[model samples]
Target: LVRTGFEHLYEVYEKIDPKGARLLEESEPYVLTYLDFPKEHAHWIRTNNLCERLNKEIKKRTRVVGVFPLKQAMLRLVGAVCINQNEEWFVATHFMDKRSLLFEELPQREACTQETIDHLLQVIDSDFKVCREVA
Candidate 1:
């Protein structure tokens, strides 16, 4: 629904800003330039460009490496990359600002009791028409 890049900012700002053109011009410089996120919600942000670039880099590396010695080495390499990506994602301002809306301050609300799990399994089975969905 939303276009990527500064367009998303400009669109939202159009509706939110009271000053109209002047505010848009002044704010455009800030929004279009770099992400200026607050410290509190300084997590959860990403750009597809960065993801594509990283994937390209990983592919290039894979081509160079050719093969892994074992599955563990592959897992370790992928896990390290995931950690680095998570670090980067937390720092991006747009993501940090927006992502907080999607989550709660408290831990996830999960009912993990045996009865709850059984009920969950039954519901899932009924919905999907697949029994023994898990091993």
Candidate 2:
């Protein structure tokens, strides 16, 4: 239904701004990614608050530092911030209510036979050889 509405809106938007419509059309695939996930999860996935908050935090921290003397120093600061944020999320309440429709689990893997194992080993050996040659 949302897709249909967007398609209709696109038609209207195209008449007003062909170039803008073309850009939107190009980005449509990415914009509608939430549709692929469970409807209950769409709200969380579609919202930009999480990303915006993280970016704001990083900007706020960087502003205090003024200038980083070394690339490694900047990296270490950003890495530490990320690690701290990760720990907070780990201890916090669930982002999405567990009782809501759960995401579909991935299918179980097939048991690997000897032939399959041999083929995988052969592929790994070929990749290793290519990497060695490149180095």
Candidate 3:
């Protein structure tokens, strides 16, 4: 459904922004790449809060330092923060269900839910009838 909904977007990107379009095209496969993972892992990995939290921490720490003597110093600080964050995650209880991972991967695609269909129809204010359908 994501691919179907984004077809027009991909086309528009291709025409007006070739570079972005190229990147999108290259990354198209990874759009559903989450499907390759176990169903249990998807929910946790789907939201980027972990990344956001890490970035926020990095920004907060960097602000405290105020200034760096060199570019490598900033990088080293960032790396240290990342390593610290990784250790924290390792010590914390895992959010994924290991039992669910024992199972195989899930279906790659699914039909849109009724709620989604209705919401989109309401937003578009149309049944999305093409000119041919009107004719």
Error of 3 at 67 (Å): 0.6
TM-score for each of the candidates: 0.33, 0.56, 0.67
**Winner on TM-score (1 vs 3):** 3
Q: Best by TM-score, which number?
A: 3
TM-score, cand. 3 vs. native: 0.67
Write candidate 2's Cα lDDT for 1-135 as tens digits.
Answer: 445545655665677679998887888888887666655665688888877887888888999998999999999999888888878866768676665545476333346566766565565556656766797
Residue lDDT tens for model 1, 7-125: 43444445545467456667666553333333343332333576786787667666766799999987777777767777877786655456545644534333356675556555544
Candidates' C-alpha lDDT: 0.54, 0.72, 0.74
lDDT, residue 80, model 3: 99
Error of 1 at 28 (Å): 35
| lDDT for model 3 | 0.74
How well does candidate 1 match the true structure, expressed as C-alpha RMSD? 21.5
Alpha-carbon runs more than 4 Å astray in model 2: 70-72, 90-93, 96-135
Error of 1 at 21 (Å): 46
